[model samples]
Target: MKRITTLAGTLAFALTVGFTPVTLIQAQNKGRTEISVKELPKISSNSILGSFNADFSGHNVSSDFLINHLGEWLGTGSDHTYKLLKQNKDELGIKHSVYDHYYKGVKVMDDMILLHEKNGKLTYVNGEIITDINLSPNQQPTSQRIRSIIISDLKPQGKLTISNIEEVITKVSNGRKAVLYHASKVEALSMKPLKAFTYYIDNASGTVVKKNSRMHDADTPSTSTTYYKGDQSITVDSYNGEFRLKDNARNIHTMNGTNLDVDTINGGIINVEEYISPVANYTAVDTKPAVEVHWGMKNAYDYYMTRHNRNSYDGNGAKIDNYYNFDFGGFTGGANAAALDTPLYGGIVCMLYGNGTLFGGLLTLMNPVVGIDVAGHEYSHLIIGRNGLGGLNYESESGAINESIADMLGTAIEFYSGSSPNWTIGEGIPTASFLNPSPSPYMRSMSDPNNVNPGPQPDTYNGTYWASTANPDADNDHGGVHTNSGVGNYWFYLLSQGGSGTNDIGNPFNVTGITIEKAEKIIYRALTNYMTPNTTYMDAYNFTKQAVTDLYGASGNEQQQNVKAWYAVGIGNGILATSEAVRNQDHFNIYPNPVKEGVLTIENDKNNVSVEMYDASGRLIKGAQKLNKGTNKIYINNVQKGIYLLKVTSEGSGISTKKIIVE
Candidate 1:
């Protein structure tokens, strides 16, 4: 039964993708200024020009350009070019040519300026119409560089602030030159010294770029620490140093220091007191928050890298920045305020923890699992932002699918960490008790829908169904992504747990009964390889089935089970009839469950048994022989590694049957 259902679902999904046209939705248009591709100068071998070209082609570009192009194609004044140079100016030591041309007494090339329009207007490389060109006389170089000026103001409390600001002067053959200043600085500030100053001093001119006077002393190191039985203790010289807790004999049990802390004497008991510190002032020079925030961020990063082998949110090793006390006032729902990835930080991933109200709310949700699933869930949103999964909140199936993907991956992460098989979302958040009428099973329940009040179930009697509506702006809560996701979430749970059997709803399904380990393997492959950014539930259904087939042959039960699960969740098989009458009347028949040599007994009721053998995608590969009634055997000797469907048809009877594999 599982094999039949899987074969049918796989075939239907293939048909859907083969025939459906995937539409690419356009994101918001930020701003647009057209550039004539012809106006850009071609690359040449002149040493200076070659060097400039090489710099442009190589690493001397801005991050914005790198983001768009990664140097895939070269064109001047494109976002790619602007971003690449903007990002790497310090490394490449290139000056902003536009700023240099305007502020410094530098001659501009004619190629840099172009006549626009039949209107005879002048324009720069990016088609910005220039009414006039003004070149100011070279001003006397100031003793205070921008970097130095900013860093000088920074007050280093306990740690020193080091600024590596570079100033470059580029001169052309005609003595036309420009001075470019690039700044990079790291401030080491300690929170212990109340009057300590952390400042950024530009290395080039020795001026402060930024400074803050409101500095707080770092936490005092713990003294008189004692070790209890089996609890090892180490007296570190500094509070900000790394310390690993060991057993009675000093065998390291766990590493904790500076960023991480525990409450109890032993490693098993974590101290919550260490987490209770006032939020750090964003404007303060010694702008370090209490240790807990650091620990959370570090844990989040480690979760992705260690558990899933994922470097960062985008699966690329993008650097992540931490933002403390992100204000979303009056929204107190979870622990340590919520942390999420934001795009504003130069596509540099960020996790922001709110003050007590919001931050606490987030932490409340995160406490259930110490591993990366929850962190991975939030981080996946960051990837969604970069890849363009519409607004975080919306009313469409898209939003639900988005949330489901997060939940799915989160569960995968938990499973990766060797955690138990549980299908509860936000198990740590306490607010669900107040918000949801039915508590305990805070979110969706996979195995028992009754656990959560008003859980997901098919509205068969009312004729309402899943994926029936196309409204994308529906925000039950941010479009009810959390709410509607139950459909898909439950579907996964049923698929994972129910295994090749009829679900509670009495729908035919194939439970592969494979371990979660195998399921994770199949799902990860499907998500990375088969799915698109805008993938819908149907796409997921199709993609995952194919993915399973690819990984474990077409006739494989693993693939079949995935198909049966989707069907049980009320997603109609486009090819299979929902009516029992039609299914019973159909005339397809294939015998010998464990047949060898690929020889199967075919019993076609009608004289017109037209056998069509299809490979997963519903693509008909060959026609089967018309078999006579009782016991006519057909040789499927050359059948490939997959479950094939034998569609036998008579005048008024049509039935699709499943064929299995021996090899």
Candidate 2:
């Protein structure tokens, strides 16, 4: 699975705004003045923001105009000001402008909105905004009692170090409620510094409002190989007519890592030997594994830059320094790779690839250097860390999501860097590890996560082999960050490559694959734009559905597939795209959308259905019709020109609903 035309020129939230279920709120008719069907704004909405498809044939407005008229649009108070955060333009020429909510000159952390534009017209506005912040930051300091109580509670065994403490307001209940809290990070000094947490102490009640993980670690199994990838080319620094395993172009350094303390290797500067050769040809036996890591990192970098347009993992071309032959003792075994902060040694953040003990030389013991996926996976963890894909600690469901995302991206990069039909993570590692020794023993399988070689993972959420989220970190692979990852890993596979099976819920399902090219973009967008820390599997459903709607369109194939794929993974019910009376499909087609003659044709594939039409203000129109199993045409007489919602209820159950222009 090694084919490089590019590295070697291979293939190339809210006021507080934590994740919550996205609720659909129908526009409640407050001021009901009927407008013509031709005059109705082409609209869309989530619980927070709305979308408008406008034609700037005559007039155009700039992003500055949107920022200036923020209050007029979202009904924010005069005390609120929107500070421009950043603007980005994709290859499709769509411009995205982000603005954060500022109340009385203070930034409300997660409360921000994103505007999508094409040419000049605003296409969509999203993200929650915080308003009516009555509590001033200068109001009061946290009481001593509360601080003492918090410190006592946190430091049970070790010294509790509280840092990065500040006051901020966060909103919940869909941004309808707000609370002020003294937010600070607390870590037990005597414990592994790896586990640090951020706490939001309620300023009023002094209760621990929330605790989130600040530790983002790529501590898991994934590997690449010089053993499998065969001979390859890598960029080496040319110095004194010698070549060193230091890629100046990509800013990557690969160290020998012969004998380093695994405990303190994560941090501190070290003067280690870089794998080098007197001449350009490095055929030394010792340099082979180092070549694997150096080559893998460059490819992973190219994969992100080439596909997603990210310059590097941090999107700022962050230098990547790595150490091969890293020794992860304590049964973690061979092939353990992690994005650890190398201390005085490199004084830079480095990804450590373990030099595993070759168990009988026929199997590699544990994690690291399993192949391109390891590099891609660890690199993805860095991206997830930067993007907050998995919040708080890298454990439980959040951690599972974090790992799953890495697996997906890793597999994608594996497919990208080379050619492979087997979408398995560590498949390229030549010698099968003992943990899951088989004909092809890879770490994780996106195509079939249930492949019980390395570990039996869940394909559907809460399905067979589902890891207990409540399990302690010391026990269950950090609450099955590696196990429960199968749900999302399988979801990505089904989303990309189409599959049919009954989920654990016993719901038989079938989804049309949107292909990896499109599917990857959807995942990328949802993870980067919509998802927040602490987003659940169900919350991911909403975010991804919105992502599908944003990238493609509502009621389209991508949306349908996205929902069904998640459903197959046991997240939400699969949605069927219904007719709009003017809805276009192969079996159904009605001429111009706003039924000109007021005659609406209904198609009932399910049980007998009832149709109800509502105006923009949620006011039901005068007419309601009952249609049979076949197609029925009904004449509309009382309906006037306005945007109406056509609710199709099948038998006694409601399938789905949307708005339409009924003339």
Candidate 3:
């Protein structure tokens, strides 16, 4: 991996020269501005919830206390109340309570708050908070009116299930707005119930203001033996002197199934007894597949917790449920697929896996349940959906982004598990012989997407078969989500491995390897905090650069490397060219050296460059440089009266010097 020095050295250089660099000050200011979003804040008993005040004691309480006291504590009378949306204990055993805010018996849309309690003391609080509102007579529409509107909208498909009508305050970017609405949720049961869809109807206008689907589809291929923690471990819950497949440590549940005989109404097998267990207590030998699934879940949980301090996929420790031996069409459906069901219960996502077809019905492939990468990939879908900052839309480029993220996290998790062939998805899983007589070993290869035996997807954005959603093709995997995702998949590989190669569009470039650790952090932060629902490849390019900027600063080499990485992936074309001018030793010049309007313009004929300004006493004063070619402008409004030296550098050009006067 390429190692680069951090900006601490620049700070030291500034101190030796007698001036604190403006770059450092700017970072401090930026930190202050983003603190509220990046860190959890303590919540007091008097913390306001809507117009009402939170009334629970701040410390030493049980889960029951939170459940029973929320309504009274928040000063919500019978008319206005709080309902528990979800609750779970984090890895640290801290209980997190998530609630939906309601006013005068109407459900608020997307208005949720969370309280994190450690050892019975409220340690932190987050989520949407509404402060401005008029508790006036905002009468909500009647349930009959809401049901009529919702039923009409959901006609011919979804069946309305439960409905909540409430009046509540919502936050706008500028301030807050109090509104009355009925939140109606619906689900349609065909062979099985599809994900529930929710709609918020404005009581006054009787128009649908917003809509949400509570379902999240989370997938896979593979047969090879891999080791995790010497031997695979499963978390079992004790019930009535019998043990069941449940991992309370990571809040995951496992179930066994026979030919997907799920009771759609109950959401699983007719009886929980179908859940598998070893004949003897606490044994991994009997339930090998279940043990593998449990181990993968633990590794994924560890990856999120140890790497990002996230408790689980939701960042709040929500439970994850999985069912194995889930053959959809009896034994025939085995080996063809594994799936994370879209249905969500109390904010939890469930996964279903099938055994391979009996008598080699699937050719060479085996059951996908045991592949660590497959488990990670399926779990990531739920994480991406539950992401609060913004979720990638489930169609087109957004959907491709969603798939690529899952693939990336899946691969990363596999690597974390000390698995071999980390660059290949389902590396240990056996492949099929559908396309050839020989059985391949991988479902997808990150380093070489085209190498997948059965079918190869485009690795470059403009590769010959690159799928685009512009012209719809329903038969094409929902606008080629699995296919086009190779673009991102390969990009991550290049970012991790540091190679010179042609991108999907046949653009040639070299990237400095940044190791998987740094690479995952950049990708995770961008996907979680910055990338919005409809984020495209171009948007990911921009957000990833911003993520690097946040972690390594604007002027550091990390940002430069980030630009190069994206360019290697066939994006950020101009960014690298601009930086190249300075490195190529092009004629670098700065005009109007004597500051009058506090602005300085720089021009480089051949390459993009960066600049640092130092005082006459050799103290670094400013360095937030992105020296693009042709009329690069910077403001030195606070330079003060002094003689200063400006240093310019780039990848091709070694270093150049210029002097400026602050008038």
Candidate 4:
């Protein structure tokens, strides 16, 4: 006996057997006996079972009972081999041998023998055999099916279950861990096909992790289908997976592509799809999560946008991605630091917390003012990152310029954000007073440092002073960015509040008492448009003048006022002095004040002037306009704001120069 191994081989044999052909049978009876010859019956080609006949008392039965009995008997084999062979022969309609046998005592005495007749028939037998015989119609071999029944039964299921479907999809898509919440269950009858179900997926784990809503929907029953919900939530999940309907609790659906029975906890059943996979730390937050950070960033963004009409850090609307951390040191207190580290100079996207001391403490205490201004300041750094002023803290005048620019912007940002001008640094910090008590005064003074401490020294001089002798890092307080910044600081204060003719350092002209608005505009324009990375106090002088001129035409008194304001603070008339020639070309001349005849003083510095008095018309009279050195006193009755031209020679070059003026 051969052992049959696979179902495929058996099925093939059965199909072959079912198609075998058969011939019609006829019976003949003679005298007391009868004989019948019948061919094997053919089975239907499409039938799972093949046809067979029953042989009893020399009679062939073609009834369904015979076919069924034969099938049952053959099916008992270890592999149904006989049944498959018979089915193949029957299906093919091929002639095949049928085992012919009779009962032991039943034999044929003549061609037909009458033993026991029932109804109107006589039974007879041609021969009888006791042993089983082999019969084959046709045999052809094909690809063998080697799979065993037990082996197939042990195979694990490949389809995903409702609980695990979302996890699998998220893992495949993002390669991260996600979580799903089964908030509600849905009844089988309430389930709809191809509709999305809302699920709360927590992408980050832990107590601080935030969750977002993702929509999962499918067109057909599938392993997974992706659905996008705005720019915030997007998800793909298995089609027949569990879901929660609005009125029902969470429920699962069966694999037959139909909804499954689910147990409800409350009112109605609602299916929720969740992200159950884990993701990396740096994935960009969707629009919704970004809103959390937006609350903080919006103030800074709007300040620049509305006040400056700047879309973002670069002036072109760009998205900023922020992070909170403390990777670098050097921050004081527990204050948080905001950094613009991304490729997008769009704004300060990265902010670090210094355990709530300097950065964080200041932010916390000054939430009223420092919040928006500091954010604005940090973001401005991002702008500077692109349109940089050389290198930050560059030591030379450039360093001072950098600090001044930051101060200007920082103050401007505050004003823009609706804060009053305090002219103090870190006013938010309670311990950080603008002026120190005794020994050493404040770090910087916009008003008068000399007033607080005698030798404090104003920032008007073109000299550098070190705040600390121990630390040569120069960056101590960022190269005294806080220290030397006083010069520009005082300059701004003086310019804003008409100059006192002298800066903190007693200089000559006093033009104090200017409006803050004009000062702000001038400083802002200079910092943003005119100043460079290498700009010095002199450069700043030039830039401020240019800013004033550009904003208020050359002939405008506003420009002249700005020049006078700076001049009053010891800053010389910068490059624009040449341009102002035609606009305010008043010949340099001076008149004696409270003159007592013998002591007439002529005070002016434009050119070597020789006073040649013209009597009414054009005649020359008396003393040379070029008086001797020092203080020259000329005898004059009284002169008004009238016209005068004095012939003077260059003191060193000997070039005679001329200027027309009225006094």
Candidate 5:
């Protein structure tokens, strides 16, 4: 499913280019390339821009050279130009520069140009450029007018304090209709450091076209005994004459939530009702559940800082803003649920907890804040939200990666804190189930991710389901991000515990188990250094494998185990890393090109060929093991008529995939 951020002022846009002059040139191997603003590729994958030797007469060039002559090179008028976004030298000694495309002094969303140079020679060029845009400025709303529109429409809760506001140009789409918009960029009101929203208001129509949440920070003092921590010294913050639950040592703050108003655009702590102060200082210790929450938040923070050397979720000394006792109606029921806004809520990263209870027939109730793994999991989500970590798109493969990584890291944090049964998330939550609640209710398990508290989780690639094709939307966990996340979760478990077992597709394999410490470091490096916003499962596998190689030798047991773990989870590309020689494309063959009755035959040089089939959507259909050498028949009689892939594997032949059709 395509997970869209739908807010009063959220934007989803694709560029629409117009006519412009350009010159096309042919490169040695690259196709004919055009140097036109409107003609440039929007994404980086297609940014080869022909060959370096063929273009520019094999001369080295700099970003400054392109900057000075870009207008003439693209034949754009004076109304548009490129502005340097940032420049940095990578770890490999390559200079990288990013530029934002501006039209008539307003920034265009996603119109970026990236230049990578090695030793003063241009090695890469990629960007989204648009030329000849007609900027007919209408008598649109001014900055104040746009701000007013946002304020009036949003009806934000609590006191409104606009942090920053600016102007920009963006393409806005109301449903299928798209238009150019002059917009006012407004930051959400800050209740704390990392709790606010960023908004883009269309000045032309006074409508919000785009927005994202700013969100994430904490202090400590010694206090009395607590229910959760059990008579231990707790941290508290004292200022002037008031005592609050903010922890100065760990930089954690606990806010009390009383009036859980939901109708407001920014679901904020209601201030008008004297609804719980910004910081809580309990009148009595027993009356405060925030105490337990404060303890859990501190544990999560320390987990990352001590284990990963991460200062905070953003790797900066930002305090954590945590709120408890959220009584928000409808969805506020704490039963088996907790929420950390994936996107910032007006720029705040706070965890909301519900006081779950036994209803007429409700099976389980939960206080999510008390669970260390749950706390760690929610906080990990904030860490992944940072600029790196592939941005782990909240849809499809990337989305599942996002969920699984969070689960794995959250599990890591729990283990770091000495929690038992480290593989289980929300293990601390008491069994609030109406029937047979003795075992205690848990959210999920890493060891057996296929079986979850709530259904729909697919533990292996073969069991995977896409939100785009299945049930899309937040209700369906954004295309089964949580469900398919089981694949990665199981991989982590296997990597942590070395064993051989039958995979979801019924393939038996053994994987070397690596310590969780090593696995975590590799995953962390991959997320921060090697990953991009649109990374896929294959990309993640490759990235993690490379990470393991970077830390350990390429041919070491660690690397092999990493590859095997990925393969065990149904990511077969790991075999390519194990041995490059076995991946020859012309080694095997399959016959009956398009099977008439869904029966396919494979002819191979070796016996014991393993086979697996998948539908057009990349979902696993069926599999077989130990096929004979010369000729083997695989029946897909029940397989529907459509395009499919048949992947054959052998111990000696590696893996070969062929596309098939059932007529």
Candidate 6:
């Protein structure tokens, strides 16, 4: 760490010396910033969930609280600090102070924390940061290098124009923990597959850092000018005697995407035009797709709320805004659909659906604006983004897992809200650009991932046709995010429907499908509770098994099936998660506090534990039972509706007595 007495002094020296493009005042001028990493609450050695419960209370606590409590962990004199990026207040009135990590006064790539607050107390947080950095102040991108990047990456005459560019500390994986300065730019490409690209260039070496496609898509499989659902009732808001395609009750609004930049193409633009019709029914031949988008989002919202107990994507009933028929480089639509948070704005999220891309004046790629499952898929991205499982860059194995999750959840929604003959993504939007396997006109297959046409869809981890993340870029679909997702997609399928097959690694296994209801619950629980931003396919295997242990007994049939499914998908035989291998043995979690449900889940890593339930009057309602090692489920159906105390004891791990309600 540099020996600087004040932040102002450091900035003045750096500026006067003409070294480093860091402006300390610029970060402070941003709204409510600087709650960054110093030290996160510690976890036990055998912990399953890398989470902590801190004792702190405040309504609008400043960063000083962190600096005071966490010592140097909150910067103080460290080389790294955090900048407030997004401020989100959900319907439940919980404030999610989203912060991005900055080191030496510049933003680091993919390092952020979502500090959650509710009822004047810090509740939860999830995010990660790279620690190893070696770039010096003088090594920052020079003005000449910036101009060179502009000329080489995007020429002034080129169609792709830069939206925003900045120097970022990119972590390089492999032998050691290190970082390199990269010029990151978000640019919109004009022709072919018209859309935006976020590419990075090594500032010193002048090599490409990597290009990631920021396509957080949620879409439907409807055909051109044809509604997939075929005439469904929709809600509309009326103002000035004109009916608009805005569902005030659900807070959903649809917009037309025409003559717009990459930012405007992806909704969240407050002043953008909303779809309006003079009549209550929006049946105009040209503007009918808006109807489908509105309806699809409604179902997506209702499904998450009703099925998962999540209020909306963020568990706070955030409004859903969507845009369809986005104009891309003179094309009516691009070739993708995405869930996006505007880079320039905080807490503003939107969905974008594009049509076929143009090929030499002919639109060749096709993406329909309506499909319930596709909409659910897109909504799943928003859900992932909010639930601490967000910030998974759409690249490498993390990106693959992220994509696969949406596929499974979206398919689950398809079963919940409508009918589906098959588990094919975008089955309604057949396109020549992306050729599906013969006789199947769709985007992807959860059931038979290997049967995809014209592309690699590996049902086993890193088996065949898997995209390598060695040097991820856009051409390889960001380390085969779409292609490698087949592995997880198959895992979910086998978990849903019983299957028997030999994996690519020559491992033969048979899995008993837990059914979609149970499987979806496990997926949701693992994702929201256990997953972090950079979770790998291998990590998913353990987390999901832990989710199973939480739902069922620690070693129930579901656990066995989970093992078999992963084996069948080439994720190895599975891990036992013994005390020796796992960490954070001190912490445990209990869920569904109201006890309205029949069962309550307890997650811990201690051994020789015991649980007891007592009534409000101190009378023992349930006798003490010897708890298992991993997870335990206690049934409350026998207990009467009243307030009760639940006590759990573990040798050397301490005892916990919590007040639980049974209804």
Q: Pick the candidate with the highest lDDT.
A: 6
Positional deviation of 486 in candidate 4, in angstroms? 1.6
Angstrom error of the Cα, residue 481, model 1: value is 1.4
TM-score, prediction 5:
0.58
RMSD values for the candidates in order, in angstroms, are: 21.2, 12.8, 15.6, 45.5, 13.9, 12.0
Candidate 1 regions off by >4 Å? 1-309, 321-327, 330-342, 352-372, 383-395, 419-421, 431-438, 453-475, 499-510, 572-663
User: Of 2 and 4, which scores higher on lDDT?
Assistant: 2
lDDT tens digits by residue: candidate 5, 434-539: 4444543566778876555454466568554423413233345546676677788888888888767777677777988888888888887667644544355666
Error of 2 at 586 (Å): 20
Tell me the TM-score of model 6. 0.65
lDDT of 1: 0.36
TM-score, cand. 4 vs. native: 0.38
Candidate 3 TM-score, true structure as reference: 0.58
Once fitted onto the true fold, the runs of candidate 5 whose alpha carbons sit more than 4 angstroms away are 1-234, 238-244, 260-289, 335-346, 357-364, 388-390, 433-440, 462-472, 576-663
| Candidate 4 displacement at residue 255 in angstroms | 44
Better by TM-score, candidate 6 or 5: 6
Error of 3 at 584 (Å): 25
Q: Which ten residues in a row have the lowest lDDT in candidate 3?
A: 10-19
Model 1 Cα lDDT, one tens digit per residue, 1-663: 001112122112110000100121111122332322222223221111111111111011232222222112222221111111111111112212211111122222111210111111111011111112222223222434532443344332333323232232211111121212222233232222112222333334444432222110002222221111111112122223422221122111222212322122232212212222132211222222323233233344555566456666565666543334333323332233222332211222334343323343443332222223444455555544443112222233445666666666666555554434366654433234344534463344445433554345231111223333232221233234445565666567755766444544556554444666566556655554334323445655655654564455444456556666677665655232111111111333344433445776664556755565666677786776666655577777787766555565555554554544434
Candidate 2 global TM-score: 0.65
Q: Give lDDT tens digits, candidate 6, residues 42-133.
A: 32211111112221221123433442333133222356665566566554455566556666777766655445564443544444444334
Q: What is the lDDT of residue 337 in candidate 1?
A: 28
Clashes of 1: 73
TM-score of each: 0.41, 0.65, 0.58, 0.38, 0.58, 0.65
Which ten residues in a row are the worst by lDDT in model 4? 210-219
In candidate 4, what are the lDDT values of residues 249-318, reduced to their tens digit?
1111111101211223332222322222232111333222222222224445665666556676666665
Question: Quick one: ranking by lDDT, best first?
Answer: 6, 2, 5, 3, 1, 4
Question: Candidate 4, which segments miss by more than 4 Å at Cα?
Answer: 1-300, 320-371, 388-393, 432-458, 462-478, 499-504, 512-514, 573-578, 583-663
Query: What is candidate 6's local distance difference test score?
Result: 0.61
